[model samples]
Target chain A: MEFNDWAILEKRVIGWIRKAADHLRASLSNPLEISEKSAHNDLVTNMDRSIEQFLVGKIRDTYPEHKIISEEGYGDGSSDTNGILWLLDPIDGTLNFVMQKRFFAISIGVYENGRGRAAFIYDVMGDEFFHCLSGQGAYQNDIKLSPLTEIKIEDALIDMSTTWLKPNRRIDQDIMTEIVRKSSGTRAYGAASLELAYVAAGLLDAYFTMRLSPWDYGAGLILLNEVGGLYSRADGEQINILSRTSILAARPGLHEYMIQHIKEQVAEGKFLTEPQ
Target chain B: MEFNDWAILEKRVIGWIRKAADHLRASLSNPLEISEKSAHNDLVTNMDRSIEQFLVGKIRDTYPEHKIISEEGYGDGSSDTNGILWLLDPIDGTLNFVMQKRFFAISIGVYENGRGRAAFIYDVMGDEFFHCLSGQGAYQNDIKLSPLTEIKIEDALIDMSTTWLKPNRRIDQDIMTEIVRKSSGTRAYGAASLELAYVAAGLLDAYFTMRLSPWDYGAGLILLNEVGGLYSRADGEQINILSRTSILAARPGLHEYMIQHIKEQVAEGKFLTEPQ
Candidate 1:
């Protein structure tokens, strides 16, 4: 896509995200009608679906040719990212939105011909908008964010979910435990996009989680790419945006160190997947 | 202390905490002069001590007879809580303050005759002030907070540090891991006072951490007390306000459930302290 096209799309998308945020704020006054997704802990609410549909409608109206991959079934389900692809997570942290009525976000990533072109994550309650254009620097609410410098493991504060520390099917608990022990601190905000935004803003050094979908970290990945951050599968492989996989994202050296640590555990036959 | 006295003191202390918050906001504009305390991860900063001294000075100038037990050296170091006592943590999440420039808090707990009388925890950047008196309910920025209802373990969202989930010297990591797997979700805000306030506000069902000082949780305890929250050492014993100890604070039923779970681990010999 041309730079002019990217700028126009970015401006329109920001307006759409702000409008969706207003809808979210209005919906919070009423009691949420929540339902379960894959598991009881995995939740979806009326607002999640409504917001996703709202974004999908806006996207379809604005760019009729663009395909969308989104949560809540408001997507084209295109197998290949051949053209303009929009990945949308209308309510990234639905649990927080339903429970605390805050800490959720609207995340959107735009890709042209399978290449990231622009991305945006709007923290609805905090009123902070993080955005980036491919090859351009990321910004937090108009201020350009600086690239994260390399941090020592002992000085790093990691962002991870508690589920990864238990006997889960994805990775070994012992390996995850070592990372927790080695890092200076760990935080779990229950919002992948916000956590990724924090990584881009240098608020957190890294964030890793097992079993996240494309919409969960789609915009985050684009934002991180602009800020000199790295992301990969838990076993040090490239992440497939269409598949559910474990993720480890961090600044340059820390990402390499974590990947090395996890690889060593796998080599020692300690990192296990669930038995078939 | 009399209700009249409590009201007057609460007004005075709120002013002091707000003033300290303003000072914290101003200090963030300058580079932090950070130093280590006990270990590399254990941090202290110039603002921590300066904020403590400022609060101490205010307390001394207003009520010279009150004794203080604080993180920095400005405390009276009184062992006995016989008279009026002030427990202060100028910056509860110093790491967050120094790193994220947000999420930290100014915590102050006022006790009279060994009982919590009034408390305050101010989120400096968020501009949220949580305060409470013994009999009255808690207030977050002048809005009175409601009491928390009973929550089931399966539906609980816990606030805990990742350090406690590993093989630490305090409690068994296996037991903590089970709690994590069972809870609905887990969050680590990296600030004890803010986490405690979150529990009181019903944003999180519980918060637990090992080796917290009196200054770290004193204000939070008071706020939780007003909202019918229960707190104790992880081993189900009363927390000593003068020493470092593990804390498990939650709504009524969930607190009991967690305590019972921990005790069961102890009975099974799975809970272990480091070999002395």
Candidate 2:
């Protein structure tokens, strides 16, 4: 696409994100109809579906040629990341949305042939928007975000979920516990998009999760790339944006350190995921 | 003291908190001079001491009879919680204050004859002020916060630090892991005062910390009490308010459930803290 076309698409995406955010803010006063997804703890609310449907309708109305990959069932059934693709997670932290009524977000990313072009992650309640255009730069609201600097693991503050530290089916629990002990501090926000935005904004030094769908960290990946951060599979492999996988995002050198540490655990047969 | 006197003191305390908040907001733009505390991960900044001195001076000028128990050195040397006491934590989440530039608070609680009379926990950066008076009610900024209703453990979201879940000298790691698995989800903001305030506001169902100073959760305790919540030592004992101890804050019957579970662990020698 031409530069002018990219700019136009970016502006339209921002508009849609802002519109969805406005709807989210207005809907907070209404009662939420929540239902369980995979388990009782995994929740989905009425607003999550409605917001995804709204985004899908808007996208289809304007750019009918673009394919969508979304959390809710509003996306086209495309298996490959060919041509223009839009990844959307209407409510990134639905549990937080239903329980705390804050800390959730609307995350959207646009890619051309699997290369991220533009991304936006809006904290609906906090009113903070993190966006990036490929090669241009990343911005938090009006201020341009600076590239992330290197930090040591002993000084880094990591954001990770607690479930990963237990005996889960994916990653080794002992290795996850060792990571917690080695890091200076650990925080869990219960929101992947916001946590990724925080990492891009340099509020957190690193973030890792055992499993996340493409839509969950799609926009975050673009933002982190703009800020010179790294994101990959937990075992230091390139991520395929079309599938579910473990993720480890961090600053420049810290990513290698984390990968090396986890690789040692993998060598010991501590990791459950089969080597790709 | 008369009701009018209490009202006057509360207003004055609120004014001081707002003033301190203004100072904090202004100081965020400047570079922080940080220092190590007991451990390398344990940190204290210049602003922490300055804020404590400022609060102490205000209390001394306004009510010289009141004694203070504070994290910093500005507090009076009172070993007992006997008179009109003010518990102050200059900056509850100093690590976050120095790093994230958010999620920290200035916490204060007033006690008369060992009974909490009033409390204030101000999220300095977020512009949220949680305050309450005994027998009156709690308020979040301008809105009067409703009391927290009962919630079961399976349906609850807990706030706890990852450090406590590791094999620490205080508690058993396996017990902590079980607690994480049982909850709907878990979050760690790295700030006790704000976490406790979240509990009072019904944003979080429960919060537990293996170790905390008196000033860390002082105001939070009073706010929880007003909202019909309960707080006790991790071993299910009354917290002495003048010393360091573990804390478990939750709504009504859930506190007892947590106590029973933790006591069972204690009986099995999983809890290292001496039983009172």
Candidate 3:
């Protein structure tokens, strides 16, 4: 797609997302019909499915040719990211939504021929949106985000999940302790999409999660890409938008250093993956 | 002090906090005076100290008899929570303040005869305030915080530090993991005062931290008390606000259960005076 095409679509999709978010918010304000999916902690509210269906309908009506990868079961179940695709996570933080009624977001990303085109992440309760178009800079509301400044690892504040650091089949505990001790502080907001949005907004220098879905990361990846931030796997490889993989995204200067230092302590074991 | 006197004092203090927060928001908008504190990620900008000094000077001028305990070295050094003592945390989440510039709060609590009298937690950027006059109720931006609903462990979301689950000297990792697996989910917001405010607001079902000062919990304690929540040490004992202790605050039904379950897992020699 041409740049102008992407820009127009970006604007249109943002509007669609805002409207969908408003509808979803209203639905949540009313009593929610909640249920369990895989586990009790893993919830699937009726609103989740209905919102995804609404987003899919809008996308299909507007961009019929584009394939979709979304959280709920309404989108095309394509494996490869070859064509123009829209990635949607109708509710990025469902637990927060069901319990706290806050911290949840609507995330959407557009890719053309496997290259990220545009993205939007909206914190529904806060009414703040972080958005971006490739090569055009990232923005929170209308304020353009600044480029990542020169920052050392120790001086950086990170959003990290501690559940990933325990006696797990992944990274080493000793190294995780070192990172926590070395940094100014750490936070786990329980939402991968919002963490990435915070990174794009420069509220957090870095964010790492052991496992995340593409829908959780799709919109954030585009925003980070626009802000000159690096979002990749734990091994410093480019994130595969279709995989449930460990993610590490940070300001460019701190990403490599964090990965290098933390990688030395990772246990040598193949990560277990469930069938998608 | 009479109840009416406390009410008037709280109103004035709320106004002062609003004005002080306005000054802080303006100073932070420049983004030029940011500086590191203990680590790069651990920030202590000029704004923190200036704000603290400004608050201390005003309190001293207005209430000359009030004894103050604070993070910044402007308050009287006291070992006990004496008569009409004021606990002040100028910026509860300094890292958030210096980095995100949001999600941080200004916390203040007053105690008379060793009992919580009034409390205030101001979300500086969001313009939301969670305040309480003991025996009344908690308020978030003038809206009263409702009584907490009874949520079971399986259906509840709690807040905790990721470090607690790591190989820490303070608590047993296995027990912490058990709690995470049982709960609906876990989150770590990295600011104790605000996290406690979240507890009072029922945004979180429970919150626990390894070590925190009096200033961090005093205001939250008052608010939690007003909302019928429990705040105590990990061992299920009365919290000595002056000492660095394990804090666990939750709805009354869950407080003892959480403390009793986690207290058994305490490491024999893992106590730390300060949170890393």
- What TM-score quantifies how close candidate 2 is to the native fold? 0.97
TM-score of chain A of each: 0.96, 0.96, 0.93
Pitting candidate 2 against candidate 3, the one with the higher DockQ is 2
Q: Write model 2 residue lDDT over B1-276, tens digit each, in one string.
A: 532488888899899999988998899889989999888788999899999999999999988878998898798858877778889999999889988999999999998888889999999988999998888999999999898888888988999888787787777887767778888999999999999999999999999988988899889999999999999988888998887888999988778888888878778877557323
Pull out the clashing pairs in model 3. A155-B40, A155-B41, A156-B41, A184-B41, A184-B42, B169-B270
List the candidate numbers ranked by TM-score, top first: 2, 1, 3
CAPRI grade of model 2: high
Off by over 4 Å in 3: A1-4, A169-175, A266-276, B1-4, B31-43, B172-175, B267-276
Q: Cα miss at B82, model 2 (Å)?
A: 1.6
- In angstroms, give how far residue A144 of model 3 lies from its true place: 1.2
TM-score of chain A of 3: 0.93
> lDDT winner among the candidates?
2
Writing each residue's lDDT as its tens digit, candidate 2 over A181-217 gives: 9888999999998898889999999999978988998
Classify candidate 1 by CAPRI docking class: high
| CA lDDT, every model vs. true structure | 0.88, 0.89, 0.81
**Candidate 3 lDDT, tens digit per residue, B1-276?**
543488779878998899899898888657646666544555566777888898888889988888898887789967776667889999988877766778889999888868998998898888889999988878988889987766677776788877677666766656667677678777888778889989889889999887788888989999998988888887677877677677889987788778767656554433333333
Worst 10 residues of 3 chain B by lDDT: B267-276
